[model samples]
Target: MSTETLIEPPLQDADALIADMGGRARAAAKIMATAPTAKKAEGLRAAAAQLRGQADAILDANARDMTAGEANGLTSAMLDRLRLDAGRLGGIADAVEAIAALPDPVGAEVDRAERPNGLVLRRVRVPLGVIGIIYESRPNVTADAAALGLMSGNAVILRGGSEAVRSNRAIHAALAAGLSEAGLPAEAVQLVPTQDRAAVGALLRAQGLVDIIIPRGGKGLVARVQDEARVPVLAHLDGICHTYIDAAADPDTAVALAVNAKMRRTGICGATETILIDRAYAAPRAIVDALVAAGCEVRGDTDIAALSPHVTPASATDWDCEYLDAIVSIAAVDGVAGALAHIDAHSSRHTDAIVTEDAAAADRFLAEVDSAIVMHNASTQFADGGEFGLGAEIGIATGRLHARGPVALEGLTTYKWLVHGTGQTRP
Candidate 1:
């Protein structure tokens, strides 16, 4: 067994702890960046085979975690994320194998240009070097982070929530074993050994050692990382997503999409939290009735409350909340502009959808919504990596720059400049 403590006890000195991880990861990432694609793929394939072979052990570990988590009063949503069944374990194995089959993003040239002054320039993809990931109770992240990091040629240091520390450790061990067997540096993917909150502080400030930090969890954790991390971060914040039923929307499509968006799976980040109804044809009553009939607790303005007794009076704060549950907030808007106004003001800029039949309205909403993913006549719940044809995702990037929407293998990579010249010199 490795001497590394995959999950350390909670400590007050988070910075020192994170710095240690950052340093190790930086060294490992340097080596990985130079590794050949065939070698990396072999490592991944070995890891997948190992995962399949150890399915029973993984299940046992996951069960122990679930038992402990439940006894400690974890919520249903948290428990769901923590649980691992045979199907889930198989899926994890499949993900590993799928990643191995993908084309390596690293070293791919993105752009090339030649200047008149005998200067040649080319932009090629390179590993970010080291990645620090802080996430909540989903132990599967251990695998996801490892796959993405290796495929993109970056070293990763993972810090999972204390709730699933044991499970995370076991999974990390499996990955390390695979790397070692493949003759790769095991440090290419290191799991922070402590549950220490201080470790997060260290990772955030490991400016030179850790290239970027990615936080994937609740709003509180995302906020903390964003605020404290000295390193650049690809933050996956709350999915306070919205679904606007436009004036010209088809009622059948709107009802079906809204129901699925809000009620299909409420605890996911991409589940729709707010529903905006265009008042041209649909009244507050009509929309509320349809939504409540589908088991949604509609909270809205006075008009909505009057329309359906099921709707309670909504506070201003309700507009901005990401209710990752069966509850929903509702509103009646005048037109497309009104819908866009509300979304712009209160959206988390994660994912939003407009259910409309009119091509013009769909175009307008798609162009205007500043969200990462905007859907027309579809559910906001569709804003998932798997839904987008990528096997899975690291998280969703609401930020506009380096990455946006679903963070998949491609999102995990960045470009570098490469040049080839025949003894060319700038005069």
Candidate 2:
């Protein structure tokens, strides 16, 4: 699809290829760690420019991926994630530029304190070195990962899904060109050239070479990386997100938000897969009808079935399913407590939202959801790094240790102690 001619070196061995890339990435990370903030920003901006300038070529490449996806029987949701047009391309470019505009997270002081003995210590942010990203289908991740990784002063090794290899290559080239324009090493943002699954194994086993691995695809992929990688991983397990319509929720707003959360780009990890309506809520039928009108199939309990024949009975598995499609499971809950309990049991701790005018209920739900992102009076789709103003995200980290929610520039970094002492050692 991309008409641009690319001459790739022959693949010798998966291990050898990974070793070479990992070594280069390690070296690149060292340089990126100390690179000036302005230079990093310049690289991001240049990549954004390249992305915008090469929109047509990128779209053509995406078309090829879409065709293949359909032939391979990819679901409509998966196909949507893989497909990209001029508008989405422009949005990706804009996200890169936004990353360029954000203040550099590196060197930011977390805290500083002076001891009585005159020893000054502070924790400061630093890049996490080389990041290995294994994602699926979405070609835009090539640009997003490069921009976020570079801005945070880290070199990245990207291994996108085989489904979008052609598109990823094209996008990677554009990003590489931008990095070169800014005098940054193109190797700083390397795309694994081959589609061999062995490469993933090699990368996962490359513990020292890669500082950390971030997986941005499905559960199977994440589970494989989590199970196999000796290196630390930042993973998003599932997006069994939910939207609860509280009794105090405005009927019109709840209906609109419910429809948007479930149907607006349903293929995304942020899309709400479940809707919980409070039993006291008077307009359950209206909310269900709205989602159905938006072409979403509603699988619900008997209460919802009583309102519309279009509603199907929800199975036990439906509660825990991340149906990244125009399908949602609805349940009627007794109150906020019931909604929270159901969410706690079924949610992947990714994101959940509650729509309510009652401040106490909203606050309680927010405090009790136990999710990476808990929103009040909003859609779960807001659970994105770009929307969180981190430019773009490497992934949505559901893990609680290093980072959680949207893993952006800040999340890409870890801090180290900077001690200023004049030979005041503890003797």
Candidate 3:
């Protein structure tokens, strides 16, 4: 659509293509599991360099994607996720280089013990084998998931959304070429070429071929994966995150935190969807005014609606919505108790935060809120794997299992028992 020649995927049948990818990834994962740390780093660094070198090509591909996306009527939030500029492309490369610098978690010792019979036993981290990362939009995930999987000694199979198909292919081409040039296995990173839906089903059912399936997308994609996949899944559901401004909150700080948490980047998962202002807060009206003034459409409860004529009366569903847009839902609560009650009922257990100078209240909220990532006096926008310094994230795992919160390198690995013994047997 942008007059850039679109790169087509391999024209194999969906099931056969996915099967081939799974098998290739499994073979590559076996080799990668024991690869020296330097080699993995080499592969990542090469990929980063390629990302920068091929910037023009990738941008052209993304331009085509943008035109198609607009024609297809994709949401503004999704288009934002799909759009790629030079700066964002460079950021992706930088994240890859940062990942390359990370200490290889593979083969790192987790714990050690010695038996009375002098049998030394230790547990060490290992790859999760082949990682099937199925993500929607955000073409940068094509690079992040590949870099992370390779860094953690697992072969990666990427299946990105149809909306950003060209963008994903362009980025993956750079990665594959770079990794191959670095002498990594050719199959180290495989991109499912087709945009067919059947490929998703195949990947979901490839239990043995794919060690783990991480679905990073909307509710429909995640729900389908969770329900149909026979393989283990790392689910990242809706980011129904909340930010509560306590009665003891500093007025200026509350305004700043609330603004940044919601309006900084409305499309991000970290953006606060619900803002709970304590009725006794020094200036609750100021916070509402700030959000409204920032071009944000504020949906408010009855009290908040009275404070600003611009405020739309919030519906009951507004509290539970993840409005990945310039819209926000605001409500005034009695205190921390009421704030906590609302969050407890509506939170998707992704991330929640409290803003208060009262250390006692902060401590209580920090300890009491049962979400995966909880913060005190900080913006929920900080809920990112890159911000958390793990390089980049596959996704925030809301499900309480193998990992939780911005999942990164450490989360990508599992542990295995290693025994160093002198022929000690059961006596």
Candidate 4:
């Protein structure tokens, strides 16, 4: 569908291409690590200007992907993620500029101390050498990852889904032009120029060349990466996000949060998949009614099924489903304790929220839940990097070891101990 000839190579060539790219990325990472903040900001700002200035070309490329997706009977949600227009393009550019404007995290001193032996110790932030990003459907990620990687001083290799290859390439070209104009190494941000899936395997196994791998997509792709990757992976298993309506919750607030949290953007990972309502709430049915009116299909337990005829009886597996659609499962709980029990059993530990006026209940819920993101009296949809005051997200890490939720510029970096001392004799 692209106007230019797409050069898809053979499967055997994937290993060589990935290896070559990895070597270049490793080399670029060194240069990017020490690049001045002003230079990085200049390159990203130029890229933003280029993206907005060349909207027509980007939109045309997106049109090609949309047409092909429609012909292939792709679902509407899938098409929506792949399709882009002038507005979305402008938004992407704005995100890039926002990232540029944030304070640079590299070399910022986190802690300092003086030891008894006349030694000074300082811990300073440093870039994670090279990162590989594998994502699906969202062309915006190409720009987000590039901007964050450049600002955080890391070299990145991006591989978007096959469905959006044309759009991704077009976006990558604009970003590259800006980097070239600012004298930044274009290799600092590279897109896999092929559609062969074997390339993914090669990237996963690129152990020494890549420092880490972050996969953002459906469960199948993430599972494959976690299972096969030799490089350490930062990924989320599922966004089976939850919202609990406490017995002391204000009825109006509960209803509003539920509708917005689930139906605001049903296809996003932050969208709520299941809801738990306290049985003692005065108007339990009002929440269900509002959700159904907002075009969401409500599947509820027997207690909730009694609230409305429109409700469907939920089965056992609905407890752990990530619908990513207008479908939600609901259950009636005794109190905050019941809500926590339910969440503990079926949660993916990505995000959980509680809508309650009772401070004690909110505090308990917030402290006990072991999710990456926890909210009180707010929508689960706020689990995003930009909303958290970070410019843009590299990914939402549900893994515990390296980075946690809404990874941004700071999370893309590691730390090193800088030691300063006068000449001293060893004991």
CA-lDDT, candidates in order: 0.84, 0.91, 0.91, 0.93
1-427 per-residue lDDT for model 1 (tens digits)? 2122334344757767667767777888888888999999999888887887877778877877887887788887788888888898889878888888788888888888897765689998888788888999998889988988888898999989987887888788888888899999888899887776777777788888988899999988999998998889998677999999888888777778888999888878899999998878463465667778887788987756777668899999999998777789988888889999999999999999988888999999999999999999888888987788776678899998899998877888888777777786555
Better of 2 and 4 by lDDT: 4
Kindly provide the TM-score of model 4 when superposed on the true structure, using C-alpha atoms.
0.97
Please give each candidate's TM-score.
0.92, 0.96, 0.97, 0.97
The reply for model 2, stretches above 4 Å from the true place, is 1-12
Name the 10 consecutive residues with the lowest summed lDDT in model 1: 1-10
How do all the candidates rank in terms of lDDT, highest first? 4, 3, 2, 1
Model 4 agreement with the true structure over 309-427: per-residue lDDT tens digits: 99999999999999888999999998999999999999999999999999999999999999999999999999999999998898788878879999999999999999999997779
Candidate 3, residues 360-414, lDDT tens digits: the string is 9999899888898999989999999999989998999988899999999999999
393 Cα displacement, candidate 3 (Å): 1.0
> Candidate 2: minimum summed lDDT over ten consecutive residues — where?
1-10
Best prediction by lDDT = 4
Model 1 TM-score on a 0 to 1 scale? 0.92
Clashes of 2: 0
Off by over 4 Å in 4: 1-7
Tens digit per residue, CA lDDT, model 2, 103-218 = 89999999999999999999999999999999998988999998989999999999999788889988999999999998999999999988778889999999779999999899
* Cα lDDT for residue 147, candidate 1: 88
